[model samples]
Target: MSHVHVPALASFLLAAGAAFGQAPIVGDIEGKEFRPFPIAVTELRLAPGAEAHKSAAQQLVKIVRADLELTGAFKVLDPKSFIDTDGLTQSTVRFPDWLNVGAAGLAKAQLKDEGSKLVVELHGFEVASAKEGLTKTVSGSKDDVRGLGHALADEIYRYFTGEPGVFRTRIAFVRKVQGEKHVFVTGIDGQGGGQVTKGGGLNLLPSFAPDGKSLVFTSYRLDNPDLYELALGDGSLKRVSSRPGLNTGGRISPDGGKIALTLSQDGNSEIYLLDRGGGLLKRLTSSWGIDTSPAWSPDGANIAFVSSRAGNPQLYVMGSSGGEPKRLTFQGTYNQTPAYSPRGTHLAFTARDERNVFDIFVLDLRTQKVARVTQDQGNNEEPSFAPNGRMLVFSTTRSGARQLVVSNLDGTKQTVITTGGEHSSPSWGPFVK
Candidate 1:
């Protein structure tokens, strides 16, 4: 039937006006979208005679506020008219000052210079309950203050959302520019992006180690798209597997103990598991047709993957220990890239309907009921669960290019999180810290 479901990622989108406006701070979707919980951020002051670092403190506050705003789950309140606590501390916060501004959550801090080291005190307060709160202290050199601000924002995120903050996490994706695709890594908010691969070869489908210290991707540097591991912090690339045929789509298990990927050295593409040391543990599936895109269950007891053994690619769940897989998708003509949620209960994948349109869908393992994640769109594929299981990162062809997009699980507040050219195959890393 020639069931080819891997379509180029393109999707519909809504306009974001406030995200483009300039204020003390700006959140991407404020009105008529997934508005983040209202929060206030104030710049803390330094000690007397520290006037030289006053500008530094102002920059640090904006840096922190901008981060939490990107989550698309927060509504960051501008501090322009809010009371300015030059030297704000937890005890010094005037709760009404933020409450009057309609801020449900507030952040106040102080930046101090302890000799050559700089220290920051950050706090998250809930005005309604006046009980949900957190205090964090980060110390580093002047250059590291920016990094610490991101860390502080992450802390506030966790305290309020119960979701592990992704403020400090990094995202690695492949981008196509001028007809050439290159791999790049950037911080969670799509900032500080840099090239990780330098070659005329076409590189794609780069997956990261759970720790994000390294990456495994398919690169055709020598005319062969083999899987290679590239270490970050340094621009070193190691070819992990270049089996005579195709080596692509590397996915590391959650435990960081094994990697499951597609291979065709045997003349047919199938799924195989490689141990942490790069030793082949076992072939996961061997069908006369194609079986690819293997995602490991959170417990490592089973694997959720896409197989065409049923005449069309469909979602299948097989024992991690190796056994015949049970197909999970029956209504769709094709389905692939089965991603397991971090909570270990649901599976999300790209399902293609008869109209040849693809959208994100979530299936609850307990009930086997499928729920569409993205509504009427151009095309939405490769849905990945955020750490909190409340959101996802996928590839969409909106804003005039194929780029990475992030949205809640229910597709309530969808947002395109990238500004780069044609990007796809976004793999969100686990909590790094």
Candidate 2:
């Protein structure tokens, strides 16, 4: 599918600080406690000739609200509490009415049908000062209401937080179907996507290339745990590594030039580096104990992996070009699947606590401080960070069925993104272009 293009309709400066007369609405995401910024998203007003698009507009509003709420930074006020629902312009909006309902920000949009396309005029206002802070016009195919909604949500998030939203990003995971594990890709909300692997025996450990155009995973369709890269655009598959023994846990480097994976061809499971193709570049680890699940740092300077060289499977970090490994986790006896944040400031991995239950934890690289992300929530593992580094997607068993869950950094807000089938090994894709 072609990428959707969303352009601003006019040049409007955001006077958020001056309008609110307060600090930024969103504070440190890593902090232990936070008060969600209350924002009101009004129903999309139907233009004169767009009366037929009521359902589409409603769906778009729902998508936008869901995206904003999933960030754990914004609380979308209920529409029932809105007093001025017909206001789509600054002159019509009553700032005091919104402020009375505990809304600091307001979002209003108008939907229009342009024959060949659908155009939406989005307006954002600061409810405290009756000032407009954002104005955008998003257009797409009539069938792409979801994309239109996500684009608008992203604009609203950036206007306030100064960071790109992950609404348009994709996620990949392994889902069991007909007793075989297949790889699937979907939007962050786990909607409007389909299975990616076919004729699959068992596909596992799916990771995305930095470009967001391809996915690398371990597939046993050919009777061996070989590494394969599947192009997401054209459905083309290429075998990246097929050693005599295990070739699994393939993670493409952030630069998209190399792959770090586990190989057992040397009679021991060790981390190895390979070129974009199937050619071997270097053997990164020579430990007698198992070393696997290599994850690259955002800048491609280092890698984090699970190693048993310290007697128990624990997290370790090393230079990408072969260097002495440094242990990162001391409290957990079993740690695996290390995933570095996009900012290179933290590492999220799965650790088994004293009760032998697996959960997610984050380690601050700067302070050497460890924080738990999930606790007593059934077994959660294989955490993959979103491109923004503020959220994570992992497999969880808390829903009675193994499913995929997206969680904020502190585990306070977690929403299951997949259901019905046993899912695991979720890898959140990079931000879409």
Which residue runs does candidate 2 get wrong by more than 4 Å? 1-24
Q: What lDDT is obtained when candidate 2 is compared to the true structure?
A: 0.85
Ten residues in a row with the worst lDDT in model 1? Answer: 6-15
Native RMSD of candidate 1 (Å): 7.4
Candidate 2's displacement at residue 405, Å, is 0.6
Measured with C-alpha atoms, the lDDT of residue 201 in candidate 2 is: 93
**Taking the tens digit of each residue's C-alpha lDDT, what string does model 1 give over 1-433?**
1232111111010111112232212222222343557877766767665667887787778778877766666777867768765234456567776677898887777677788877877776777655435777877677766677777777776666554567667777888867788888877667776788887879888777877788888889888878888888688888777777877788877678888888898989988888766678898888888988888887788988888888998999999867999988888788988888775777889988767877888776766766676766678888776654556788887556777877765566677878856888887766666
lDDT of 2 by residue, 327-385 (tens): 98888689888898777878888989888889988777876767788887899999999
Best by TM-score: 2
Segments in model 1 whose C-alpha atoms lie over 4 Å from true places? 1-36, 84-91
Candidate closest to the true structure, highest lDDT: 2
Decoy 2 TM-score against native: 0.93
